[model samples]
Target: MNCPKCRAGKLQGITLKTKQGAALGLDQCSICGGVWFDRGELEGYLSGAVEVLDSPSLHPKLAVELDHCEASCPRCAKPLAKSKAPQSPRIQGDACAACGGLWLDAGETGGIALAEKVNAAFDSWLAGLKPKA
Candidate 1:
């Protein structure tokens, strides 16, 4: 499937197991550092299906959300909302509050959800198990 954010490239196929042992889809970038998510997958990942387990030794890439920015959903061209990361509440992501979609910035794919530090550790290790680089 193509990225809903932009026609930049097609979404890669990736299924990563979270620390909680739930499998989440991983949509990596072709040129830029971003991860695309199907609306349903995003919510499920956040709702604790794929719980994160964080570790300080791991420097997972942080997701910088452009939700409040001008960037719109490539599919609907609707504005996205800034929602707190699943693992960490402090970190945020560009979520299409209208469409239930999410937009993660370049390199932010690996960052732990700021809501829970313990979950972040497991999330990071699980994030590293993707099919590609």
Candidate 2:
């Protein structure tokens, strides 16, 4: 199993909790900003059924869903396919249609859970800007 992000070593298997507080295997990369997911893991993350660990980078309060498209399954090496969640479209995620594996980057894990905030921030920033008549 190659590290999906760095493409160096096999992913070190580490179970991580999703936003919803369920346990899931989320490979840790430590070196680069990346993690690996097996099949159906994305759905769990998106649903807030799983949560990333609590760390300076990982937000414990916020259920973070991982997002990364340019990653391949440690086993199959097929380019991970991405799809938008029906609920949160602003976020992009990758999955292996063949195997159902998933991959998410560092910040991506937090974006989906807080998507509304992202939109709100954008809207607020736009409101502050002068509009051209």
lDDT of 2 by residue, 1-133 (tens): 6666556545566776655566776675664445565665556655554444332254533224233226676668777767753445675656567776666655666666576457769999998897767
- Residues 1-99, model 1: lDDT tens digits: 545444456656666676577788756555444566666766555565454422122123222222223556644668766677564465556777666
Backbone collision tally, model 2: 13
**TM-score of the candidate numbered 2?**
0.56
**Model 2 deviation from native, Cα RMSD in Å:** 8.9
Best by TM-score: 2
TM-scores for every candidate against the unseen true structure: 0.52, 0.56
Once fitted onto the true fold, the runs of candidate 1 whose alpha carbons sit more than 4 angstroms away are 1-7, 19-22, 43-69, 85-88, 113-133
Query: What TM-score would you give candidate 1 relative to the actual structure?
Result: 0.52
> Candidate 1 — worst ten consecutive residues by lDDT sum?
55-64
Q: Indicate which candidate wins on lDDT.
A: 2
